[model samples]
Target chain A: MACFLVPAAEAVITTVASKVMQSKESAPETVHISLDGSTVTEAVKTPFSKKLKWLNNLLWGGSALLAFEHVWHGEVVPWFPFLSAASNPSDAAEMLHEMSTAGVTMAVLVTVVWCGMLAVSNVIENRAVKSAALLPSSK
Target chain B: MTLLTTVFAAIICTIIWYRNAPKSQMKIGILCWMYWGASLMWLVDAVFEYAEIHDEYFTPAPIDMLNDFYLGLSVVALGLIIWLVILLAKDPKGVVKSVLFKKKI
Candidate 1:
């Protein structure tokens, strides 16, 4: 019933990680002189934070939607013993079971999809780098 | 039914993204990813539920189907809202910034 919590938890972690990575990344250079005596700088590579943001967007969006579904079904509530399922011993047990099975499966599937996106992005970035290396600079 | 809604939304967003790939600054890609990911999640949910319920899964009550369709629409609306917030905050096209500055001037 509360399967969305799993992904929500993961989203929280990734959001924190994104913030930390952003802090650690170097500041942009203020000035650059190109090989052709131009002052323009090359396009900077996409930062790790931006990639993490893609995952965050996916996880958060999915989790929020799923949570809304649960709330609609009255499985979740605002007050204490937040999950309606938690109010009953048998339902709570079933809820945990569902979390372990369906919830975990959903989280894992989303993460796998995110990994695929990362792989595609890496390939594109590599191709761009290769092409840029082969091309002659022009003023 | 929910899966179908998300699938349609994803397809529409993908088409829009493709058409404006050159000069669009709307960041429609984020919306596309969100809908596609949710569609995949719901697909898995449906598969697991189908495994458990077998024939019953095919004949969900009419009321339940309506509820699901509404839920799917709400999800799409929520995604759009989030994307709008991001777009306004980022102001990729400087539209919001220009409006605010124009007000002051």
Candidate 2:
């Protein structure tokens, strides 16, 4: 009976959400329009450059996941490139604690970088508003 | 039902209600709120019970705080359901009229 109610209720939410999404589909995609209309800004686009950009973000995300895994499993893979070795919970567990702490540090750093970007955007927006306000009268 | 089971039940209900809610609504609607409140009540009950059973002190984890925030979210979900039933029962015609007009009262 309890399980029955769970699904019964979820169906209701889904029905409502789909209806809302249908409405939103009619709305304009401002972000897509802005990005698509923008002129090329990159200095150079090499195959290596694209690969590095993708790989850098991938590795950063992977590192974060690895750090979180340390909170539970603990080991940071002692036998990465070599032969088999002992895999003890106590041993791996201690190692992971350090890695998880490292993950927290990296996440905090990423957040700070975003905060700086937001500040820059705000400064740019303020200047744009001033420019628009200072437009001369035709008469 | 046991506290843990009840908590599980509430979580399950919260998901159901959330998924059922009108996607167009901005989550503050009655059904969303009701589900949220009920879910939180159960979650806190379960966690407190678990800690008491294990004789463990409450040490806050970031994830735990996040879970607590989820409890807050479910409050709105459960409330939405209550409002849904009320609309269906008390003044069915009026409810339908308002819903058709996209005006929640």
Candidate whose lDDT is highest: 1
- Per-residue lDDT of candidate 2, residues A12-122 (tens digit): 444455456555554332211111222312122122222222223322322322222222232333454211112555645543553344333333343344356456755
Candidate 1 residues lying further than 4 Å off, grouped into runs, are A27-41, A135-139, B59-62, B89-91, B94-105
- Candidate 1 lDDT, B1-105, residue by residue in tens: 888899999999999999999699999987887887788778779989999999999999999899899988988998899899999999999999988886634
Candidate number of the best DockQ: 1
Q: Weakest 10 consecutive residues, lDDT, candidate 1 chain A?
A: A29-38
Q: Summarize candidate 2's per-residue lDDT along B61-91 as a digit string, tens digits.
A: 6776565555434433334454566666665
TM-score top scorer: 1
Residue-pair clash count for candidate 2: 41
Where does candidate 2 stray beyond 4 Å? A1-86, A137-139, B1-105
What TM-score describes the B chain of model 1? 0.93
